[model samples]
Structures are given as C-alpha cells and as structure tokens.
Target: MTITELAKQWQTVIHHKPPIEKDPTSNDLLILIPGNPGLVNFYICYLDLIQQQFPNFEILCISHAGCDPNSYELFKFYGLKDQIVSKYEIIKKFVMDNEYSTKYNLYFLSHSVGCYINQRMVKLLLDDMSLVSHVDIKYVGLICPTIKDISKSVSGVRITKLFNYTPIITVLSILSSVLTRLLSDNYLLGIIEHYHIIKKPALVDFVSQLNYTNSTLGALNIVSKSHIVKQVLTLACEEMKLINEEKDINDWFFHDLGSKVKVWVYFADSDHWVNDKTRDELIKDYYDEDNHNNIRFELGKSDDGITHSFCIDKSVEFARITTNAIRRLN
Candidate 1:
C-alpha cells in the first residue's frame, strides 16, 4: 500500500484486531499513541519500521479525537483529559472485545505529549480493580517525551505567549483556508528571502514524503483544514496550561517503576519542545543502570543530528533503536 493510503487507514477510529489468538505472542499488545496534532499520518513510516522489525507483535496506533480525517465531518474539539479518557476507553474495548486473559501484557509506545497520556492511562488502568488483576503492563517506550512542566519548554514558552492572541491566530487560519483553495496546485510563495526558485523545501533529503509534490499536498491539507489548525493551537494552549508541574503531579512519577514495568526513553540532545532541566532531573532521580533498572534513559549525542521530530527523518534508524531496546529487556 502507498504511504498515504496506510496513513489514512491508521486514522480510522476502529481499534486493530488482537493478534492471532493461537500465536504465542498474541498475549502481547503494543499500542502507539502519537503526540499533539495527534494525526497518525506523521508516524506511518515509524509504524512500518516497527511492524517489519517485529512482525509477530500486534500493534495499534491511536489518533487523538478530532485528529482523524473522517472526524472532520463534524466540528468537535477535545482537550487533554478528554484525550486520556478516550484512549483509555479504546484500550479497554480492545481488551474486552478480545478474549480475556490474565496472561496478557500491555505495552505502550508514545511520542511527545502522548508520553503524558501513556503515564496517566497506565496509572488509571492499574488503579481499576476490574483490570488490575487481569492484565499486566510490561513496557513503556517514550520518544522525546513532554510529560512534565511543558509550559517551561522553549517552544512551550513561545507558543504559550501566542495563546494570548488566539483571536488573531484563528482569523489567520480562516484566511489561510480560503487561500489554500486557490494555491493547492502550486504552493510556492513569491519570496526573495529564498535563493532557490523552489516551490517546496528539500523535504526529500530528510524524508521522501517531504518532497515537493508531497509537501505541496501537506500544505494544502494544513490550510484547507482550518479547524485542525485551530485544534492544534488550542491543544497546545491546553498543554501549556495543564501539562505543568513536576513529575509527581499525578503521583505517577513513581508508579509502575522498575519492578512493575520496563520503561525506555530516548530524547534529543537539544529539543525546543523539551524542558531540558526537568528531563535531566528525572533521569538523574529515576534512572538506574544497575539493579531495579526499570527505566532506561538515552540522551542523544549533540552531533547525532536527531531531533524531536525524528520520525520524519530517521524512522528506520529510530525504529532500530527502539526495537533493539525492547529486545534487550530481561
């Protein structure tokens, strides 16, 4: 299937079917939750990598409510708590619809703010007496997590400042939508700042899907869906407002520690969307290389060139990194 087709398919609201009941690995369920602008489209390449690396593992990717393309039929917006609840309900249904078993182990793969949702959902599920004894949470993988004090992040600070001018942003989004219809075929702007006669940036260098043709299409999608633009901005504002506080805000910092679940974290050396100070402190306090090493943290090398949005440029490489981490679990 084409990359665009696969991404569109992933955006569906239906949960993926459980692994083949007879397969030995059927008991293992891996769910990927993407960050804000939680469209599953951005992570399609990464998902393909994981599936290729671990064909036996059944995977489900969840897009935040209102991010699905089909959901555009109706105009609705969801906030942070709504996302957490929606994800939890989806997982619950996935579990219940399949054969119930105590042998099942749940695994979570998350990116950006999805990391925040993963932590809360894990805690919430564990707290429930109904499923508490029925299922086990085995592993959690966080890529460039934004789980704590997001308001303090570089981008968070900048975006939060923009929140005060939401009316202006909203108006611009509406204008962009109107202009998008007139510009879909050729998206280049008549700008002297750019040296190239280029219509699109060199997205092919990082990711093939970022080429001139694809990027023009992407721009059209962004502009045509003004609601999505507004939703993304709204979500960012909500994130800055609510995704604050230290690690223990929900008493989740210490929950599902080394003994209960194995957690792996990979972060860029420099990320505008990350609260570096908070991430460093969490690593120092919670990471243990020796015994009780439930959480393993990897800080990127400064020269490695991976960024917060690694999926676009390094999906294969990052997928290899993650699959390797999971394989090493004892």
Candidate 2:
C-alpha cells in the first residue's frame, strides 16, 4: 500500500487514500493517534491493513510533535494535553479544508496513551461550537490503553519512581544526543537487533518477530537524529500527573458520549502499563448494559503473545483485531 504523506519537518501525518479510480463511497474518517514516542512511522503496516479492511474510509495518522527528528529541533516537550489539542486541531483543519459539512462518522483508532488523546479529541471535536459539528465521533478503538491510574500499575510505579526521583530524562537526553552524534544508523540497527543495550525480552519480541523493517529502522532513526528521550519521558512524567484520574473518563465518555459513540478497548493479556484489577473494575463498575450499551472490551489470552507496544511485530495481528472491532461498531 503506497501511503500519501503530508510531511512538515519530521512532524508528519500520513494517509492512505483509496485509488481515485476505485472511487470510495463512504465519507467516514478514521484517524490513528499513535502511542507515546508518538511517531506514526511504526504504524505503516497497521494502517495498510485497516485501509484494506475499510477501503472507503480515509485512514490518517499524525506523529506527535517533538518526537520527529527529520527536522531536528532542540528536544522540547508537548505534554499529554497538548498532544490531544494538536491532534484535534489537525483533524479539524482537515475537515474544514475539505468542507465536510454533512454529518459523517469520525472513528478514532489509538494505541496506549493515544487512547487518552483519542477520547479527549472526541470530546473536543464534539463540543466545539465553532466547527459546525459535522464530524461526529462514531467509534474509538483503544488498544492497550493507559487511560487511568497509570501510576498504580507496575510499569507506571517504576516510571513514577524513576521520573520523580531521578534526573534521568535530562541525563538520558544528553546521553542519547551524544550517542546519536557518535553512532551510525547501521550500528544502532545492529544494536537494536542484537539486543546490545537494555534488552527487555518482552519488547525485543516485537523486533524479533518482524525483521528490520521500515518501522524498526524508523524507530532507531528517530533516536539517532533526535534527542526524543527527553521529549518522551517529559510527556510521560506529565502523563503520570494527569492520567491518574479515570472518573473523568466516566464523566465525559460513558455519560456524555454514551450511545452516541461506540468504544472498544483491547487489553493485553498482561500489561505492566495497565493494572488488571483496574481493567476488571472498569468493566464491572461502568459497563451496565442498560446504560452504557455502546461500550465493549476485549481481553487477550495469556498465550496470545501480543504486547502493549503492538505496533512493532504484532502490527498485523493488532490491526486485524482492531479492524474486526471496527466492523462490529454501529
């Protein structure tokens, strides 16, 4: 699938438009808000699969600001809220430029922290009296989300301890900047493939499953050219501060957007980022069939072997699961 990209510096939003000859009929828009380290480079295959599934819908993704190195600027930070607003503005501009005045479905396909951004984007887009309300948020597919109480999760606890206590973000940013200057892309790729550095067996499994594809290379390329470590961790620290609350999610989405939008969340069999108990509690407390009939949850089995960072090797499988969920949405 050839992706048509609108690139501005490293900040890029890629889209797959059905061949003009095919002349797509559906006016739906599906926007993919990528996980933190918010580069859309990791999701080429995922978007391709989704485009194949819904040939009519336009599939688009924007890389999070400060994460892209293609036009490297000093590593600055855009917190989680900024990311949400940025995406909303981009989507809104696209809709306005295209003059999509008639009501149409807006489906949000997001991973990890992007889920939080997705929900917020939906709220913002819906509530915006300025935009004419042509874009109705129809569905939100949250994959391995970190929407609430992340500080309580295992990974969240570790990250909170590290970020709060240590100056790791600054130190690592300087270190990564130096390393990028010293190292070659090929060298970095070798290290990534060989697990020469911090080799978490769980994460490398994504690279192991998929050979050195563009996704893997792009992941390394960003690190080599940009000090995104600071940007990533900076946003992460803010996420720890802001995303600890979930009642807000219940207040806005389950109550305000209930039935008007369908929400599907897929959970990893075991995710350090999302607590299992919290996941269960969310299902039990909020999912009253009479009230929140628009919400549905999918759980991965222990042997399913899909990780939270599903964009790497598991992109195909995750895409299949997500597209399947989209098919079921009203």
Report every candidate's CA lDDT: 0.68, 0.73
**Candidate 1: worst 10 consecutive residues by lDDT?**
189-198
lDDT of 2 by residue, 45-90 (tens): 6787777777767767887866666655555567777787777777
- Which pairs clash in model 2? none
Q: What does the lDDT read for residue 85 in candidate 2?
A: 76
Candidate 2 clash total? 0
The predictions' CA RMSDs to the true structure, in order, are 5.5, 4.3
lDDT of 2: 0.73
**Could you give candidate 1's per-residue lDDT for residues 11-87 as a string of tens digits?**
33433534433455447778898887676655666766666666656678777766664444545567877778777
Candidate 1 stretches greater than 4 Å from native: 1-22, 99-103, 132-134, 165-168, 183-220, 249-251, 289-292
